[model samples]
Target: MGNHTEVTEFILVSFNGQPQMQIVFLLLFLLMYTITLVGNAGMILITSCDSQLNTPMYYFLKNLSFLDICYSSVITPKAMVSFATGDMAISYNGCATQMFFFSLFGTTEAFFLAVMAYDRFIAVCSPLLYHTIMSKKRCMCLVCISYFFGCVNCCTQTGFTFSLAFCGPTHVNHFFCDVPAVMKASCSDTFVNEMVLLVVCGLIIVTTAIIVLVSYIYIVTTILHIPSGKGRHKAFSTCTSHLMAVSLFFGTVFFMYAQPGAMSSPNQGKVVSIFYTVVIPMLNPIIYSLRNKEVKEALIRQLKRKGFETIMDNCSTASEFILVGFRDLPELQVTFFITFLVLYITTVMGNGGMIAVISADSQLHTPMYYFLKNLSFLDLCYSSAIAPKALVNFFEEKNIISYEGCVAQLMLFTIFVTTEGFLLAVMAYDRFMAICYPLLYPTKMSKKSCNRLVATSYACGCINGVIQTSVSFHLRFCNLSKINHFFCDVPAVMNAATTYTYLNEAVMFSLCNVIIAITTVVIFTSYTYILSTILKIQSAEGRRKAFSTCASHITAVTIFYGTVFFIYAQPAAMSSPAQSKIVSVFYTLVIPMLNPLIYSLRNKDVKAALKRTLGKKRLFSMNR
Candidate 1:
């Protein structure tokens, strides 16, 4: 077992060695492959042909759908061939090639999901900058970057796998040329390759996970400030699908790759691979796309329009169909103005009231309270950045936001939002200390310590904001000012830049690595300590209370970290637009909605406060 028996050509043990099973396997895989093609192709078609889907988010989705097609094709066809013909023999080169591309695309999808999460963070947490931050050019760059990285990863693994001598027995235990199976075939010492895979795969999983976790920390913290239940619900709805996707995708992938072959059986590996390679791909379209109201509506509208044109015998061009046009609606003026007034009131009332409450309540004068105050301030800034422009769009009908306005909005919004993430994570640690190690909570998170934590969060956020904004804005914008989304996103803005962005990307990637790494360590360490302390609690009642408080936070953290880590950590070539859009919904809409529910449902104090507030509001309104 030390050196694999000279594996010249590997015989894949197809789904089953039985003839009937082979036929069934062929039918099943063919059906799956067909579905994969149809689903991915349909997503691309719907996204591309529909004018409603021209936005950066949809643009990302289109790339993801295309990737899905490519990813599935890499394995499904080979599987189908084996099932159909009973030829389990893959050439040495064929096996290596298959393994390389399989790893590349699979890894690429992981990053793509992470990018989508960041997109969501910007969209939900910094709505004003969504357009600027996630511009067309930036989106294109991200997609290209994702693919490039995937290629690089493929080259490394493929080159290494091929480099090894495979003169041993040709039978590959699994269906395809998986890393472990390929290694098993190698006659030479494959210990190096195995170690390399272990290190690389572990880093990829861990790094991407950190990014997603950090992003969600901010996402959840920001969402907690919302006063309205409906608003919270809306946010949660957007994020839950993403959370599910992250859990499914990462759980399976990490289980497959993170565990060394020695520890996990080949059967276990096969089961795990099936999740990422087949089941996850099939689930992604449904999990991310179908769950999205905008995507669904767009699909339905596209279908209806196609049907209507066929029935009428008159082909109306796709350009003529308006999904979100503000034209020819005079009543929109009144509606716009009212919408603006309401948002303005909400921004002032919700954010300002939260600030006032935290400030006035002496009982809340702790490290955690300070973080909450910062959160309130962030919410105010975040809301202010977007709501005004939105109000204007509703009334003006044209919805034309200027270049300078977009840039300014994006920069400030990033500052606040990034700051919010660090702040919330800091708060989580503070809470963890309070709940886990109650005796040391005051000393550990003292006033001075609290100030330091707040300042550190601001420092991290500001630095990230400044670097991103400076580099992002430094790029000369092309005349393609028609931003698809309402806000400026990082990718969108970069994509629109007229100048070369290689240097900017280098800087961006570097910064992402550093900040994401730091936050990951901090959050992971904090959670570890918290978990340790929670387990040590002598009383079950104490443990339950502690876990309840931490559970909601952990859930929020899991969603955020999972998304961000997956997206930015990958090499640029693998960043697909379709994947980005899917992940984006989680951080943006889903997290905001989840935070309120998590907090209210978990903490009786918060629920009581809310009920009291609502009761008072009702009495006052009735009296009036």
Candidate 2:
């Protein structure tokens, strides 16, 4: 056992790309993995739980489904994490274990497909002897035989691959620890490893494939020989699902491993490998259930029972919700992921930068900048409450949020947004004092008074958020699970209610209208007096200066209210779900990113403060 392996770990260059594209791939792979889990698990559950599916075919089918789950699970979760974080390092033993298990499951799936084909052949070719010939004892033996061969093939291949000498480089140039990729990384002679790969992998693949082909051929002949057209169709239909699954699994396996160097390129190998490893598992359950009539009926019955239980409890009080996010525009999911990811990053950085800038600079320690800092903090919280989960949900087909999660998100979003609105009104008043009563502006907008105003905004916001969240959750959601919009908006959450939502709707409108009504009155009154005072200024320069200070606040308030009003002011049913989502996106994602930009770019004081801070840093460095 002269194992002189110098490399302790290998980098699994999985899904390498730009950061945005990596997120897109993460979402893509994550969705496939989730489907693989649910679909295969459902197949196993249905086959095990249902009494009608007691035959040899279904016995092998569930085993194959379990193997599919294993096959996908072996590599997908690690690959997805790598896709998200760009950390692809796998330790030496970890790589060996991954290779062993993946190979075991993959080889087992091959044998299981062939075994299923044999079962199909027995039913179609020797119809009367189907049960007695493929009995419970024999079926168990056949499944055991598949596992035995899989273990043997995988052990020999993995042993040979890991027994190689010192590796030249630790990079495996592939997503997972496949034999060829690992062998190529070795500095030692890989002739034996290649031989083992070729001989062992070839034997298992060719053997199983031959069994499937021969079984299908005999079954086809038997079906063709049937006198009646209906008999022929019935026999052929039984094998269709198995044939499809076998073809998908074997076709990808052959393209990747059978014809050595047939990969043509690394990228080609990866794409082909994905079909078998990631995509095929997700497809198998679909192929089996949809094509087989018995399985479909069993699934329906199972669902009806489960649905009855779920709806009974959930209609009274929802346990969870399925967020239907941009499902209509499925093609643009990649674009949306990339776009929203960029927007979220920008929002966090922009708002975060404003907070840091205001906190760091003494020149920015005024009543106006103090309120600006609070606004930045509010926007940051608002964006965070919705965007991270929304961005991740873009990857999910069924974006599920727990009932408690929905309540928490709704409350947090409400608090931040409500507080921001009230704060905008406060800022307008500060602007009014600056322009109209310049001498007493300092006293009127004093630190103590500014703190009180901001505190009052938060107090009002918290009360609104709590009342809204509590009422929304209390309403019975009935059987509804698919929420039309992303995140738990009050309107969307309210629409999901099964019972009379009149009280919820009234409380909702009452709180929103009151918040809007007071904030709007304050904003309008302050701006009206500010405008009057500005117009009374004698010089053109004086008018411009007065308007300059108010412009950014005006922009922020307008953008915030326009979308907020569009979403919350109208009845939930009156608002189109799509229109509401788009408007919500503006206020939740785009506005937070834009607000910091608006205030920082438009206000000269902020610019001067930033310059002074940077100059101090330069002076300090020069002194050092």
Candidate 3:
């Protein structure tokens, strides 16, 4: 309106003119676009067709897949057209439109993921009220809200940019009409618009991440109280996928947006964009689908059926549906199988022996002992759930677990896991009583007391199982039932659900915070008391002995809770996939193995028990 001349179009600059390079770009973009379309579209289609995926989480995922498709559509088509026609022209209005929608969808997806994290926190922390918290109507309302918020946010940016009158140059430096580039072309003052973009986008990113972080902090505290290695691992695994995705998306997005324009290069900016926009979307489907046992099984089932139909059409019989790509890698398969076999054997022997020793020894009868027993039991359940599938997948040419099997696995796993969290807190209290109230320890936490604590742990575990299984079972399963990890963790399972999950998230958030707060209070109080007692003791040896006993437990708790708190508590804007993967490995695989090793090696009583058992076995063999 300020200028007499009208700004109608903008010219986009292309990479250095080389016909070969252009052809390569054309072919590459075309292929990538196809994969993007097929992968995302297939997820939607499969989720729609599959009855098992009709839950709140899956419903969110379908929208996410569609969003990814939309995101890709915004950027890729323009690039493709540029490649094919060598016409790098985008009208001002066209550029503005693309930039707005792209920002809208991208930001929306981030918020949506944050919502998903809350869903997981609920499922893991509050097993009792998950249903009431995450009802269908509530989930739909959340999703609607998310979309409405996204539209409103995007429209604001678009309106601001569109209102700016372009009087000078009409050339966008990059392939698309990105916000920064569009602002660069404006003759009018755009500092306010840029500032607005930063403040609003930054706020959304920071807020979502903060929620996820708080949720995880509670989750880790709960996991630490678990006495068993397996149970803790199982609990951690359900969150692995979402944690990874959140980290990856937030990390790159943060790097791209948080910096000043002078600090960012077009090349580096493009690379950053590619990480969240392209690589992450592709990785999402693969990570959540291929790595998952249930999703793999579902895919295998679908493929087998398709294969049978193909054979029937060809007038031939279909005998077997073998996963074709890795059949020839026999040597690699054998080595992998053997490696896992040894690990599985060790896991079973080590965890089983711990359980047996805890149960058989009456001297070990206490609330602490019960917690250890639960931990060992959880370890066995978790290892069995993951190892066998992984082992089978390693050796057998095909890997699959039926839908019912997946649900059952997910259910039992959730039960043992949730129970482990509460058990850990109970164990902390027991420790506090033993250390702080040593004079009345026998009176306060007698054998009868231990039994009741044990009974309560199991009862709570059962209830947790029922709640998660019920919530999961009621959800509609879509065709996208592919899980991305070795086990049926909550997020992976949720990925295949077709219903809205906001209610699921709310329940999860409430439960996680409550459990975390309770356990943290008890544990913190106990530690404070124990520290005071140790300080007062004149005898150094006595203090050392007391401190030694708690050392291994404390270490195990710190490691378990530290990673969890870091992953879950950080803003989604701060984490990256690389960081997420590292954490997932820690909570799921490393911590489980470490838990048993620490208890066995560090605790003198446990070491003594093991030595006695081994010696007796050796003597019996000699006698024979």
**Root-mean-square deviation of every model:** 21.8, 19.2, 23.3
- Which ten contiguous residues of candidate 3 have the minimum total lDDT? 316-325
Summarize candidate 1's per-residue lDDT along 370-448 as a digit string, tens digits.
Answer: 6756766775676577666655665553566566677677788767766666666776777667876788777766777
- Cα lDDT of all candidates, in order? 0.66, 0.82, 0.66
lDDT (C-alpha) at residue 413 in model 3: 70
TM-score of each: 0.48, 0.53, 0.49
Model 2: what TM-score? 0.53
lDDT agreement of model 3 with the native: 0.66
Which number leads on TM-score?
Answer: 2
**Which portions of model 1 miss their true places by more than 4 Å?**
1-8, 16-20, 261-264, 307-624
Over the stretch 35-132, how does candidate 3's per-residue lDDT look in tens digits?
46756776787676666676666767778888889987898888878876788888766877898888888878888887787777787788687778
- Cα lDDT tens digits, model 2, 1-624, are 365466788898765633323533553566567658867887899899888897788899899999999978899988877875689899888899999999999998889998998999899888899999999999999999999998998899888888887553578878899877877777778887777777777888889988998998898888889999998888888988887888888888887777778534777888788788888998898788755779766754565555422223434446888888788999988888898899999989998889988999988898889999999999999999998998889888679998889889999999999889888988887887788888987866778778767887786688578768866776557443678888899988877765445546775776677678768876897899899998899999989988989989999999999888878876763358888888788888999999999999877888888898889899999999
Cα displacement (angstroms), candidate 1, residue 133, comes to 1.1
